[model samples]
Target: MRRYGPAVLLLLTGAAILRISLLSELYLRYVQAGLRPYLVVSGFLLVLLGVAAAVAGRREQEPHGAHGGHHAPRIAWLLALPALALLLFPPPALGSYSAGREAAQRAAQGVGAFPALPAGGPVALTLAEFSSRAIYDSGRSLTGRTVRLTGFVTRDDDGTWYVTRLLVSCCAADATTNKVEIRGADAPPADAWVTVTGTWHPKGSLGTDGAWPPVLDAASVRRVAQPANPYERR
Candidate 1:
């Protein structure tokens, strides 16, 4: 058991990775969809390495120690705990706590014209696009059009609440929050996913702090299941 500690740890870790990336879509919670292939390859390699190491260990003679064979450090087994935990219970996607911790950072794009929205009412848009157009678009494309947005609910200390989503460039570690303050509808439980349908409520002039968060006069808030890939890409 002592001589096989490293190989066991490697096998467990690799199995955990494969469980998340190859067996299920759970990997989407932490990484971009495009990286799935890479994760699969890495996990396969790790499993292969673990098998090779175990075979090599078995062939090699173990030096005799006071007990019998050389003993591995007790701490070596601790490394397996995380892999086991991940295998059995993977972490949930970043949610309200993550969104609330982020500071409001408006996009760097200057106030400018946005392409005309497709002719329609209740256009479906990502929170990032909605925030960008609401805060920086001089055209005010969202002014009269009803739009639909989906995100998890997050509340402020003052009873104010938002429909928030995290934007990620590569992985969960780089996630940033993009949220819109809800005006009319009562907020669902914190971290509950919802689809908000409403018209934009204009605030201060575009591109100012006052315009931040971009209010939405929600007409209807419907509870929805969290998406498989919750994070919006940059």
Candidate 2:
């Protein structure tokens, strides 16, 4: 077993990757959907390499004293533990904890006219879009229009809570926070997924610090299962 440690580590890690990217949509928790094919390829190659290494190791003749003098380091075996964990129990998507750590850091965008909302009933929007329109749209596109947004709940030290989502350009490692302060509805438990329907509660001047984070006066807040792809594309 010790002699095959490298191959075991590679195989385990590759299987874990394939378990998430190829067998299920769980990969979406950590990366953009567009990168799925690359993950699949990477996992496949790693498995192939592991098999090759194992076969090669088995065929090579070791000198009689080789095993007596130098042993495979114990630390190498420990490296497989994470791969085993990932294979059996993958990590959950980024949630309120990640959101709570992020400060309100809105990108500067000039206040400009946003396209008109679709006519009629409540429109579903990602938290990123809702935040952008509420903060920078000169036309006040969200005013008087009911909108629905879905995200996990996060709270501030002051007891103010937000319906928050993370925005990722490539993967969770690069994720930035986007959230809307819920004015009327009670906050669900931290990291609880929910959909809130409401109208924009405009405050402060457009495109200013006072206008940041955005606010919603939620008329109805309904608990929902977390979406398959929790991160919004940036």
RMSD of each: 1.6, 1.4
Q: What are the per-residue Cα lDDT tens digits for candidate 1 across 173-228?
A: 99999999999888789999999999999998888999998999999999999999
Best by lDDT: 1
Whole-model lDDT, model 2? 0.90
What overall lDDT, based on C-alpha atoms, would model 1 receive against the true structure? 0.92
Highest TM-score model number: 1
Q: Against the true structure, what is each candidate's TM-score?
A: 0.96, 0.95
Kindly report which residue stretches of model 1 are placed more than 4 angstroms away from their true locations once superposed. Answer: 66-72
TM-score, structure 1 vs. true: 0.96
Q: Report lDDT (CA) for all predictions.
A: 0.92, 0.90
How well does candidate 2 score on lDDT at residue 152?
93
